[model samples]
Target: MAHDGSDRSGRTEIDHSRRRVLAASGIAIAGSVGVAGCLGDDAGDPFDDYGPQAAALESTAVSWDDLGDLEGELTIYSGRTRDQIDPLFEMIEDEYPDFTVEVDQDGNEDQLNSLREEGENSPADIFYTQSSGALAALKSDGLARELPEDITGAVDDDWSDPDGEWTGASGRVRAIMYDTDEFDGADLPEDIFAYAEDEQFQDVISTRPNSGTFRSFITAMIEMEGEDETRGWVSDMVNQQNATLYSSGSQQAEEVAYGDQDIGLGNQYYAGRILNEDPDATLDVAFTSDDPGCLFNVSGVAILSASDRPNLAAEFTRHILAAEGQEFFVDVNGEYPVIDGVEYVGDLPTVDEINPPSFDLNALGDVEAASDLLREEGMTV
Candidate 1:
């Protein structure tokens, strides 16, 4: 919305009182996230101090002791695949030899349900998810714990939890991907909703209504335009009769790039991957300009309340948020780094410039409402 890095999405801030209310009311939500394997044994100082107080305060600052003597195994559950985060696992293993991190990656909802069912016996030391929605679900169920104050000290208050249950890691913006041959750049819809109503986009647009991406977009609509408006938009999308509902953003982007569809809604990375694979492909990204439909989603890390290794788990979490670990995204995976100063090699838009309409809810944190909306609209998985 603005280049100042302030959340320009116009999202209304939830006062501490409301957050306490949610914490008390125990409303549940669900979604995806991932974890990585452990590596070598040379442990570094967790609190080596990056620099001045201001610099430390600007990042997810954490306290640390030598990981050399810490003896523990921290289990993590994630929705991100191994291929995407293996390097991170190796880094942790090599850097913190005394602490081993075990990773399990699966779909967002599946991982959350597993944690809930496991209860106190859950092996999960940390929980990582694709969106805030999943964390919200755990929070409602009394499964999430507050993050360490020092670890969260540097992140902007709005970007992190008041109680530190979860915070945005790296962010990806939602955008429209289209076959440039079929739809000229000039013909792209200015807003996301209009794409559903456009006659040419009829049957030509593909979507994943039940997936996390769609849920995030719909949640944003509900937050920005209210429930009625959001529902109306969904109805219009269905009326187009041209929309094909896939299971995920990557698949939808694949369909659009392969000429199976003219346009699709997806995270920038899906489209980026496609272009990287086929430079000759006719696919191109069209970020919404009207009310900017772009949505920012992240993979979050948090310590599970049931973990036996809270201190070690917290240290691992600190490592992930550290400058070196955050920059691993550029060298290892193509995904954006969660830490602020790291550079994102992908051609995605900066989070601040996206100018998406901010609403009262965290897009990922409102899964139940979104799930109900999708079901009410007859959009089953």
Candidate 2:
């Protein structure tokens, strides 16, 4: 496999139509993606501009008033943890005090299951999850409603469902989050296969075996490499290298940063979010020599078909895609903003430069086989 960010890994070279699901950062992809948080109860502009770039930000971002008098309760079944998105809820409250957003956060699979089983009586106005796969699943089941035009149009066409059932709220790039003091990322092998046999990485590595994005990556492997090869590679790497498995990407990055392990196979933002809190922390994110390990997965929102509050539900999605919401997500969570013009904070690579895999994003919806394969290898799913 070539170390440069080119398509020498045997996978098909996808064109722009297929490329819609993924966007690269200028710092990471060098092509697309032109790309922060806060607290408090203020009486001034409910949705005030954020950061130093607030005034200079493009005024095209849809505003709360743009949705036309949104009101009523909005229940959310979210995969994003409370701490990761408190700022979002706070802004919503400050913007529309009459509108209610009650969130019940859980694993994406669990919440997805709830939505599937609940159907019309799900009590969920929105399903906000970490995996586009889950959103795809819901869309396939006819469980999600078509988003309003403004909400759908707020983001790039590729970042949302082709049918407009869901829209990506924020994105995380798959990368090797490493302890900078331990290894120079620039010299790290570009091929993901290197980690399994390369003596330099051996037992010093950590990963999230059950992550939604991890399964998506496995699904891509199944599409790119045969199932047998992906299975063999995973089993060999886990057993041969004595790899340590963590529950979440954040934990994996934390363990590596503290020297519990030297390297972590996880999303790029986990390290950035951690670094913001502890500047002295010896953690930072690095990409694969190219795109092998860099899969771009998104956390997004969808309106539930059963929702009686379509106006409010659409308005919430609208708020999320606009500038105020985009800033809060990027600044606080360190994830990529899906829309252009929003400020991108942190030292992470631009979305275009990360070199995400070319597998069609829409195809990632069904990954039960991949999840089962990971579990069958005696790995946690």
Candidate 3:
């Protein structure tokens, strides 16, 4: 199989439909908020700007105003891309003029290392990351503070830490993104391991071995199937089947849409993004029932234990779990809301409907072991 190296430079343009939906949801308060510049031509009434897609979504039960006033200075170490997270922070800033935020944007590994080095003196009040493994690592290292019941109770038990150290804000599932033009959804196997063992999929599936998401998937596999079995699967894919490599999940989804490959292993949101761009893109996402391929992971948030503004940090964390924050993730990032009653965009099933493998999310923190296995298999440099 040929290697099409990672394209880390390009950023996907924010879907306009998301903006319109957010506007109607009252999370985007265009004219009143500083985001008026980013959102062109406000329709005066936020509801007036929304299209049919926005109209279908029910209004969140708890609005930003319902969260009440938040006043303080909080710094965040965010692993999510600026394009994705900045708008949400901007909304928070606009809503609470007295509350200001400073975001340090970088890769998850880099941010985690920096926090460890800084120890008790780290300036970050919150650590918001795209990987559950990273959040679990923080909890294990004693860098995260226990969250309040109100915050942790908002999401399901599977989405939050058992000890209350961190809570998932939004959900993503591992999926097989395939071109509908080439194959029927029914033709795809429900077991993720089948992609390696089956001959029909050889040299036709693309994967991002270097992504943090992929690493977490491997970690879960190790916990469930043990290292040796996981190692054999990785070895077969890398050394025998010759799986193609891409730099990002989004790119893998795009290539599948273009018929460059029959299928690609990536998160569900990547396909949502492509469909958001063009609903007729000929790409659809499939899941592996009760398998690690359908791992339900989250982009989560945690209050740092060393923060001077613990009260303020807790409030901010709560805000992320609130209806407005949950809707922002669904509308803007195409992610599933971790909280109840917030509808996910597109025709995708709910988190419960996905029925992912049963495992402790915190157990996925052994990403070092996963990375080492990938290196041993020569899947990554």
Candidate 4:
């Protein structure tokens, strides 16, 4: 929890022309597509046929006890910090008086490695991480069990695993938070891509992708815009001498509030968490032009492949993904719901209204590709 809120010197921007020019060239040839512009067969219900494989896993009648029963205190290694996960624990206790859910907030890499080495014997039964890289890794290693059929059918098609391994429980958008006092809203860059060249924003932007959250954001960019284009954007970010990088998203938000930097390219939750902790923190979200660059990051929940409590785990998983579970997700956590109906608070734009770029969840399951992209951008974190 060290609060080193200043920009790190000796940090250099990457070369931008190669990727950006190529992407712009391609888009120029293909023509502009509407933000909510539909794709082939993407027209139907979001999760029309999700979880077909998971549906074949088990056919037991879902029960409250089945979902709630924990022979022992169930352990959770979550990406959420103590305050964020605390409300979830309280909700479980109230709903299922029969069992207890114990949680520990561990770093993303630690939890990923634990699940990898320990496999089915791992002490962690459920792992919630901010990025999909670990999920892709677990799936690649065959460490993830197919999600429950019921859970699959409930979430958006874009949110769940087609192969039934892991599903996105909640999502966060990659948005910019700026201090309006220092920069006028009308004068703000219209697209994040402009930050690299916009003279008005020079040395005023900061971000952190070393963490899993930022990793996914970049990966989504590569998928939507292609490798060269994404690489170009990162390079431009460096060339413009834009973006003071940090180790985490919350750190970036603090820099904006203190005026060390005016804008931060990070998740919306980091700003929300800061507000929850400090009511007077000055910050507001900036929406660049809706494109794949405005990536929608998934924070997913997956049952281990070797769980002795599959039934109990499935029950809990269903509860979290269900309508009731979805409501608590937004009401308490401020995350976007994966399920159909849930109310969201805050002044942030709605998912549809924001028209954030869409990325295939299946593609998100590719960790090697994600890792490679990060390295290509000269990102060590």
Candidate 5:
């Protein structure tokens, strides 16, 4: 998790001649038309359309019986909503009566900052967050403990930290959400870069460039394709002038589903959430090439370095990695399970088959460059 030391504010203010100036300047700004103010994104409802998981969906990850019960009360500082995590926490309490959890949920980024302020005396035993960026930041701050191989080894190498500080519980993929009423399935293109020239989708697709997911997507795009090319695509979209930015991904997806736009850029899980609220809704996910826009991000857990109950914290992580825990995330929260063997309850392509680009999820912790690109284009996050 190395910082590039590049400052986003250190740019020469440009004189624009419509779209041509940025072409020559080699740095495009999001047009003022559709962007949010470009500073930051508002917190979203992470538990939208959440429900209890299925009765019999078993997990392929470690079993509670295999791990054994060794828990007391543990306090969790969660960067996800209570509804997003309650079902799983309730499951742990019901199965192991002695293990109860007190969860305090807040925005991931804000909570990360708070933890840093608290330092070694932080009361949290477990830190569960919605983005790997927060997890990486914690690890980088020396606030996370290295997990034993028994916990870290349950999931694949890519799903956990390389230095073994955190483990991904569930995953989400970036997607193109299309309005079924506006375009037939074939009209939607899977490749986003190729979609730039698409007539129907031009000037209509929306995203929250300021949102955490959107920033991560753009950062990963920068990693997959160099800065200039990534900037070029955004410039093209900006030149179209109809490419819009939203306050949140779900709102962007809803606008597409409501027919205000033909397509939107958001998490694939968001479409699933819409379907949960309205099964007959016309919203559908149109995936892009496995590069930037379609990259996967995880909501992960880690035992804090300042825990008062380390063993209980680690056991809770085991419960989350178990089959039932994985099922809750896939079925209830509409996420891709990182632990193998849990059946995903949606129409999404299998996680392993998505063919997303290879990049360190940790490296994408800083989305400053991507936000700067959007801001320069005159767009907000």
Candidate 6:
């Protein structure tokens, strides 16, 4: 869908003025209201009525009430599938009759290429994608605009651009998906590198070289351990260890649960998805301590430099950072919320508890180098 060139003149002066004041004062309007106050009596208590999942939405910093009447047209070039992020836009559309969004969902690479090709004429107000590497790539290409301080301040600095180009909307940690029937979490190596060097893990662990998550992991490895070491690790896993390669993280999790493999390199949420489908699944997730295997990658959103409706785009981006938006990610996608105050819903430890090694997330932009190394090592097709 394309923007119809409609203006924001329909919004009330008070709504526009309120947002401006909040932005100027560096106040987070998204997190200012309570859930009950935002929902009102007719909507009732979401936490009490909607059960545990709804509880994640409670005490959120941002509410629909704070956003005011978000009336405008926005075109979002999303790397996440429609089922993953469209519902949030659906909620926004339902809440504000005047607001409408057009989502062009495609692969992250394709979307990034299109944004680059379109240049300043691109209709995309927002670029929502699955990896920080892609967001950084856009920023490096000068396709992204600096977000407002209020929006940037909502999330932790680690998950956002140091230059204020993009902000992480949700997070996932690299974890070892192991078969509960075969081994306990304690039995696994604490360091991810051990799987490549240790004989015990040989021919038992699975990985997805073609997966975006894996590429991002490799990118982090190259940044932290240097390219030579990172390339060697990939080579050892593929050649010496006889590591099995899967098509996707979910497949890796499923294979491990089925006992086809003792362990697999995947994301924490893949296991959460498995349990959600069948609580009795023989799968469990384990994390590596202070290693690249424990890399915390995020699916983030950015405002494009070519966007004409930056204010509306900022509001929508803020909506994703708000309490309800964060809750949707945790409750639906089994991902962690990037903002503070929103409680993590799953069995895994919170982001702070995971405490992934502090690396420059923006450095992940050079994913091409990681991919080249993977190909040179015969890791991908």
Task: Provide the lDDT at 352 for model 2.
Answer: 73
lDDT digits (tens) for residues 93-134 of candidate 1: 554556566677677899998998999889787888776677
Candidate 4, residues 251-320: lDDT per residue as tens digits?
A: 6788887657888888877776666556677777766666654677677888776665555555567656
How do the candidates rank by TM-score, highest first? 3, 6, 2, 5, 1, 4
259 in model 6: Cα distance from truth in Å?
A: 5.1
Model 3's alpha-carbon lDDT is: 0.76
Whole-structure CA lDDT of model 1:
0.61
Instruction: List model 6 lDDT by residue over 108-178, tens digit each.
Output: 98899999999999978899988898899999999998877767777778889988899999999998888
The C-alpha stretches of model 4 lying farther than 4 A from their native spots are 1-71, 94-97, 273-281, 367-381
Kindly list the per-residue Cα lDDT of model 3 for residues 1-381, writing each as its tens digit: 001233235433334454345557665342321111111112121211221111111123244444435666778999987666777787777767777787888889899999999998998888999888899999998999877666676678888899989988888999999889887998889998898888888888778988888999999998888889899999989878889988877778888998588889988888887787788898898889997899999989988887766666666776676667777787667789886656786656667678798778898776999999899888883
lDDT of 2 by residue, 105-180 (tens): 7889889998888889888888998878888888999998776565566566666787888988888877887888
Give the C-alpha lDDT of model 2.
Answer: 0.69
Query: Which runs of model 2 end up more than 4 angstroms from their true locations?
Result: 1-60, 63-69, 289-292
User: How far off is residue 245 in model 3, in Å?
Assistant: 1.1
Once superposed on the true structure, which residue ranges of model 5 sit more than 4 Å away at CA? 1-59, 239-241
TM-score of each: 0.76, 0.81, 0.84, 0.74, 0.78, 0.83
lDDT of 5 by residue, 1-381 (tens): 001223233222222232243223433221121212111012111212111111111224544444446446777888776556766777667767656677777778778888999998887878998878778888989999887566677667776798889988899888778888877766666677865556666777777666666777778888888899888878777676458878866677778777578777788887877786687888777677667878888889988888756655665687687666776776667789887555576765667657666668888667678878988976674
TM-score of 5: 0.78
Clashes of each: 24, 14, 0, 2, 10, 4
Error in Å for residue 272 of model 1 = 1.8
